[model samples]
Target chain A: MKFNHACKLILKNLFLIFILTSGVHGNENVNDKVKKLTLELRCMTCQNQSIYDSDADFSIDIKKLVKQKFHEGKTESEIKKFLVERYGEYILFRPLINFKNLFLWLFPFTILAIVTVFLIFSARKK
Target chain B: MKRIIVISPLIILFIICLFTLFYIIGNKDPNKPPSALLNKNLPSFTSKSLFDNEIILTDNDLRNKKIIINFFASWCTPCKVEHPLFFELAEQYPDLYILGFNHKDAAKDAKNYLKDEGNPYTFVGVDKDGLIALDFGVFGLPETFLINEKGKIVYKYMGPLTDKIIKDEIQPRL
Candidate 1:
């Protein structure tokens, strides 16, 4: 009976150690994920600074919230969508490629295509 | 093909000029970025009252009433500029529910500021760490939101309310 009690206590300690070490490693990855996600977020209080770059209270709170959301198993796009929904598209420095922004994204390429077509015709004429 | 090429540049220039004129004539103010929460349901929150810690106010309590949510801080000078307007608003619209959020200010300081200025709010909720403001997407202090009876955030104004704004923009909504 005495030996069985000691073995049970030993198993509990081993389980606790496993959880503690795993939690520490999980936290390291969580920080890295938080950094990457926050770099994409604008600090609403400071207005042009990235959340990762600003030391403002608003930025700090956002960083914590992002970290918490990541821990809650939210994906990067999910987090971005959530922030965009709350703060609007102005918060995203890199605009999404939606139908509204499709024109914005394709404009330069369209200009280049037009220029290329014009140049090819002019060269053929010469 | 040669004529098409010659006309394409003119077409491009015309489109550019058209968009530029549209932007200019649209009267878009660069200073004010439009609020995302417009026409959206109010974000839920349960906050302790500034005057009484035991007293709590939640999003549900605001339903079926026209609410004016004003985020203010004692440290914000612009909030001070719009301070007296709340009093006038309360008087004119007795049925309107004015929910004041004491945002990020020390509790004592918020109390003192309200005491000095006179509390025009129906209920003052303390947003001590600014989490509530974050949920509301409050970019800065002195941001005001008008909620309709259904608890949808119908309009949001991000600056001090002038008498002109109150008369023209706000009174009509009320």
Candidate 2:
């Protein structure tokens, strides 16, 4: 009975914490939130630019979409995922390291390790 | 014959190294044009002044002061971050002329936006048509071109200007 009561109290505390934190941080101005998130997204076509970079008519339209998403109260990650769904993975500036991109993430370090090992082995043999 | 065979590989490797170096340098910044554009006369065009809708600012009028031309749009996010820095820069370089090319925006919207956000520009030009942007080879908004007093393009930054760049990169050139 005591164990069940303790677990209930812990759950209550966690719920209260969630409510307080979300109330404080979640009420950011919709425009500010959207502006902050847009810069983090990459431009689809323009090299090394964010969606917020280009003056293309399409970019302006995307900004309008972002403003709409803000009103929907979606999180930053949710907005990014929605963009990725629409435009594919190419929309992101920093590609997420996942199962599909595992090779890309590991290839650079693997090549560096191979080179170091080859150099050490060649030197020791000599 | 043996010496030639061994040296042949070495010479080929040397050529490959040189080619690789050139390729790396070439691909470093694809947006920046060749050095030929630098020190060339600023392109001439007439654009509606952002400050006054009826008035037009000619390229010839821009010859006297060292100007920093920023391409920005109301929809651009990085332009928001770059906006406050421009205000600080205007404060620092009172004599420095800062002009903005408002690419494809309504004059009333641009003016109202600037008024609300703090107008950092000395003069704003409406590029309702992106012809002016094309002349300068602009691929994106928030790009900055620093022109010398003689209207020669001295420096161009393809991204948002940070405090470090203002202090370390641009102030020295000024």
Candidate 3:
């Protein structure tokens, strides 16, 4: 029983070690970076889904381009800026906080502030 | 004071209603996504000509002339609808260059479609992998971009071209 248990434990460790070492090398780092960038990019075809979550042809092309750009030594920001320059700010899953979209970004916070002020005044009245 | 407070919300609602009405009345085609390439220089790309694979077309080829870049695919139904309009425009304005960027389509099918529909394009480039369409930020097929002689994109139309669009929007610019 002890020999059988020891053999099973050895096999499990060997399997894990094999899996870990196999993926630790090569372009895995770049792939992770590409995945992170793709997650933030809105899939233009789907409109509502991120490229990472979409299987649309455009999303697939964008992912390939992202990985290729990374391989070409472009930084994440450069890739994002390139995409934004072509696709506009709409391609970002999060709307860019710019002068044009300032109201869009601030509206929720502004509403919260107004509600808080109203609550405080109502509490005082009570 | 209580009456004033009660009336304030009603006034606000009235203003909101007025604003909504104004927006609905003022804007046409509210569903059209704003083109990012408007007023921007054409995105540069190189691709093989759809008609002749040996011929390459670059951004420079599209410059020095007022051109209409139409994104189309043989599979897109709207493109077929707009096909005759392009032919009409091509004949009406011989100086105006109509370049077709075949998006995400097989080369053979694109050739066949053009053959059947009557090719109006001065040059057709195959965007087989859709990288060129991506450069143009094209979300849908049958999107048209009008580039001025200087190679800057002046206008974009998102859907099938109608006679009204040609007369009202494109004719004035041309």
**In model 2, which regions exceed 4 Å deviation?**
A1-126, B1-5, B8-12, B15-19, B22-27, B30-36
The TM-score of candidate 1 is 0.86
Better structure of 2 and 3 per DockQ: 3
* Span of 10 residues, lowest total lDDT, candidate 2 chain B: B29-38
| The candidate that achieves the highest TM-score relative to the unseen native structure | 1
Better model by TM-score: candidate 1 vs candidate 3? 1
Give the lDDT of residue B165 in candidate 2: 81
Candidate 3, residue B86: how far the Cα is off, in Å: 0.7
Write model 2 residue lDDT over A1-126, tens digit each, in one string: 999999999999999999998876665577677677777776544666776767655466567678777778777888777666434455666777799788658856765665576567658766
Query: Model 2, range B1-174, lDDT digits (tens) per residue?
Result: 955754554466567657757975866654443333456677787988877769889888887788888999887778888889988888899999999999877777787789879889988898886767656655566788888888888877767889988888678878
Report the number of backbone clashes for model 3: 0
Model 1 alpha-carbon drift over 4 Å, by segment: A1-21, B1-5, B17-31
State each model's TM-score restricted to chain B. 0.91, 0.85, 0.86
lDDT, residue A107, model 3: 58
Preferred candidate (DockQ higher): 1 or 3: 1
